[model samples]
Target chain A: MSDRKNLNRAVSVARGYDPYTSEWLEHEFESYALLREHLPVARTEQLAYRRQFNGGWLLTRYDDISACLSDTDVFSSQSSDYPQRPWIPQAIDPPSHTAYRRIMNKWFTPEAMTAMEPHLWDFAGELLDKMLQKDEFDFVADFADPFPTVIFCELFGFPLDDYEQLMDWKNTLMHATDGHSAGRALAVAKAKELGLQTPDEGELPSEVAGQVYGATAAALYEYFGGLLEQRREHARNDMISQLIASEYDGERPLTNEELLDTLFLMFMAGLDTVASAMGLIVKTFAEQPDKRREFIALMDDSQKLTLAVEELVRTHAIVLLPRRVTEEKEFEGASMHAGDQVMCPTMAGNRDPEQFENPDEIIYDRVPNRHMGFGHGPHRCLGIHLARRELRIGLQLLHQRMPDYELHPDKKPELFGGMKGASSLWLRKG
Target chain B: MRVEIIADKCQGHGMCNMVCPSVFKHDEDGFGYVVAELAEVPAELQDEVRLAEVQCPERAIVIED
Candidate 1:
């Protein structure tokens, strides 16, 4: 068959299994492996297979995706023409995006993250101690969820008591991958339920369309208004306060809107990505005892935990970076048009056989490890240093305290919903 | 090892000076201007140097053997 005919056939086969169908679990698993094998770059009807908003093209090939990430000129980050959610700035192209990023970059540096380490360790240790008392607990809900949640709360000076509520909102937002509109509706609904008016469903007198547009702006205005006020009065060594004190263009500081938008981005970007990664890390370590032991040995020998954290990120890349095509571009002979959205799957990119030997398997000491877990180029994750520290401290303490931890065989991990995480990863503590 | 600073990229982040004051001192520009070179770094200061390297916002400084 001709290439076009072959492409058509492949697309049909891909569409045969709905990417969002929870009932198609077997098909989804088979497709994940099959797509990687067959058309690693083939198109699909999967909403996530393409950019959710504009039906733009998605590129799964490792090299093409990386190139897209580095080449920001052809891709725009502005949400002006595209249909996007409120917290989409991090995924936008650069230049304009850089201003917002600059406002909050300092708070996520290694020094800032290190300063927050004591609090993170205390939180992780407290959670682990409680889990150890039970000796067997759901890893995702009991451990993975709380690790990033508490760390983020303490780091930003937000109340730790709000973690569960935040997690529910986050879950609603992230797990809507399949049912994009419905999922987002549910997320907005949940956000409203939490007394925060979402753009889609706020109690404004405006029309539904206007409400959708104004809800996020209004809610954020109110949320950060209070925060900005609090920080201006008493600068509490937290992220919000730091940003308030920060000067841009040698001016006073970031505006209230900017602060709220960034904080919202932080919440959207942080929670699930780390939680998913933690689940993957625990699951991977549990499955491969030798590798886990090797990680422990590396931590013990180096006494510097960042190396292990790097290895963990390299091994299981959680978030895939998405970019939009601004002009007609051809990558590897595939003609991509202007306005096509491309996703650089960091997991797939990190596992490229050309990049790493035995790409599918985890290499505990994968040296010369230059993976795009945080991404490459200017728009890389601002909070990467902080995330790395949290991962290092959380993993090290967990291993040291509960050395003989294992996945509980009674409860098989259910990888359902829109998340690629184990629903309930039960573990037996040492 | 000597530490070199590329001033053009430096945004006066102050992270380097905060991390390793002895090894790096800020100039009038407010950016970190490396002031010292040591062939052998003390054991206590190793973490400080590593932290400085990791914390540099502009990635303007390079430590070489």
Candidate 2:
């Protein structure tokens, strides 16, 4: 097949050869390199119901992605763009987004991180100890999955007993093989993966996926809503209580929908991203012993460890958000229409050669590194304090407990292309 | 040298604190704040402060001599 044909096959939004599949997922950066060099803003029709569903322009360059994120006016994040309900501050923009952020910002403040540091350390230590006690362990199931999940649940006041199942719901909705399962469930998931903000009712997300995701969403809403009301009645020193009690501009406070949507966004965001990061980072260490040693050397060095966390995140940014053009506009040499889906491939931006020296390398102390791992602009990650602290403490505890470790000799970790993460990673301690 | 972090642009990316802790410290919100005693970057830490200025993702930190 021609290079163009191969790239097309790899970039397909709808079917057979999507980025998440082996055709593109395994060679993601190589394909992204091609896309960046030849077609910075390549457009692709989503495979499923191409007629009814709209395709989008994939923004691959670092500057373009950064510009679009910063240019909120032309590229809207309003909930209307999504087929489903809005995710509070993530789906809102400007004054309103800023205001919503201010309320949650208190929960992620530096002091909050400082207070949570010991707990994060404890979580990391406990997980690492269990993994280290044995010579063989599945890092993904054992550590990556629970560390962030537990911290997120604890900070937000979710019942600790439900951690495993909440994570299962997240995995089911996100990481299932494309188009492989029951109707609506698979379609909603695939449509989501394809960055299809709005899918025609009959086009995809068969009735089952809708019901499945709907049930999951409703269950989650009730879960958080119950907590919000509880907190409303009896406040606690947790994030949910703060959010429930949050008020601004005397606008009669946030409605229940607003709180639920915000919690929904938090619920989804907090569960998977960090686990993905840990999976990818651990997978790399398993493969690259040298980098692992280098990382271990910096375990006690706060400055170096902090910088290393940023660099690792840059090397392996896991989240890719979808934005729709508000109106007709010319962006990065592409003429796009209103209501067009534009995927901001943050990970691709992190690897853009124009943005970083040795862009593909894991330079532990790369300085002046302005990578968009946590994203950029007004809607940048609100949970960065917690994310950073988790990364640092997680790695510190693991390396201290199992300094010399590698991938299980018999089994290799499974990785996905989109929002990359290991399905399972087997590690062996020395 | 005077060092101040512009609140509008700062997204609490802690680069300033990492680069020059003496001159810059993270506030309760996790955003870098100019340390009161060291706002005027001491001669020894001036270079570090400049590096922080260049490295700040939002370019939030400004060191004015």
Candidate 3:
């Protein structure tokens, strides 16, 4: 039963939705329903500072979002502000994207991901053991955050010791704001204007956040540059080595910049996404014991486990996919111009009532659940197999180790929007 | 039912192969394609073939009776 009050708030948010305000993040599903029903082509002018687009249309309905994702020619991934440099494959359009993808497809196949299962299970068991040692611990910090990040580091050949520092960089890049109280006040005023909660402010302060973000990116480029050189000298059995050995378009080796950019994308995309998914999903389970019990009952059955992971991912879909309009066109009753932005919140599309019979309900065995959780079209997540394996293994080991757990009464889970994640999720064993 | 993956639409999400590996296998580049011998789904796997068809995010699978 959707709350009418939430729907009213969502309607207000749709009218003047600002990316920086975080209002839409709080009541996301309600916002999705209201926008999909009332304003299928919702428009917002308040752009994030680093974003290039001045104004954009938000597509809430599944069909519209899917159509946008599929038509790469019309809705280009080259929407990033960083035109001088782009994340390989992701920001590239076909046939270039196709070529880049060809080089990578074999590496992320279901078979390849399946090979990593034993190692993933072992690592998850180790982490879960450490986590269960404490009666009450932060799920995000203890299990969710480190579990995926460590696995990603091992795969990418990054040092395990640098995970903390790398996470700081990622946090700064993804979540940190200008840190200006004036800006925060303005955003709060805007949220108030929309009759929403106070905006979730970034932890880091002004100039610091920007500096850390910039420095972190530069450090990553430099770090990868050196690693690539070492791999070139004598290739190891790691992703960096694999990239070094693989030819680009069956031509020459990829340029240093290309290698660096690809690694950069990998670092950002691989590190935090699954961790966020875990945080959100576990938080959901902690709050809903019935769902937790259902999940635990199905844990031993592989097929049911797979479907459960998919359902959890569908319900907790996190990415807010952005695209650029390459040419002027009339789309879904909205006039999209060349150079305009299109925000396709997968979270919204995954929950659209028009697409699913009961959009909000998490049906573990929901078939044809072609949800946009991993996105759609050519830009579908390259790590889909790995992500699924990680989520499944993570859930399995978590429930096996601690069958019954609940949120800590004193500590609260901190959820943030825009590639939404839980910064803090404290859980206690029963 | 006989099934085929539309090449142009298949971006290799590999959901088909995951759903029914016996019927769906991927090429060297990992894009899903019907196993040549099993392109015509066995009676026992007909349900799985249909599941794979709908699970495909790209809607690349075309099934015929």
Question: Better model by lDDT, 1 or 3?
Answer: 3
- In candidate 3, what are the lDDT values of residues A42-138, reduced to their tens digit? 7766542346475678889999999999999999998765423789878899998888888888988898889999999999998888888999999
Provide the interface RMSD of candidate 1 in angstroms, 1 decimal place.
7.6
Task: Write the candidate numbers in order of decreasing lDDT.
Answer: 3, 2, 1
Please give, for residues A1-430, the per-residue lDDT of candidate 2 as tens digits: 6878866654553233245432456676876777787678778665212223355777778888888888888887761323257887899888788788877776786556778888888778878777777889889889998899998998888888887667656665555443212323444664476455545443343444444556666666777777888888999877888777778544667788888888888887888888889899989998999999999998798878878998999998987766777889998668988877777778889999998888999998888788888888888888887888888888888888778888899987767555667767898886
lDDT: worst 10-residue window of model 2 chain B:
B23-32
- Give stretches of model 2 more than 4 Å off: A1-17, A20-23, A47-53, A79-84, A177-207, B25-32
lDDT of 3: 0.80
Q: Report how far off residue B55 is in candidate 1 (Å).
A: 17
Off by over 4 Å in 1: A1-40, A48-54, A79-92, A176-222, A232-235, A303-305, A416-419, B1-65
CA displacement after TM-score superposition, residue B24 of candidate 2 (Å): 3.2
Q: A220-297 in candidate 1: lDDT tens per residue? A: 446556777887899997877877776655666666655666677777677776777788888888877887887777
Better of 2 and 3 by lDDT: 3
Candidate 3 reference-contact recovery = 0.72
Name the candidate that leads on DockQ. 3
DockQ-derived CAPRI band for the predicted complex in model 2: medium
Candidate 2 yields a Cα-based lDDT of: 0.75
Better of 1 and 2 by lDDT: 2
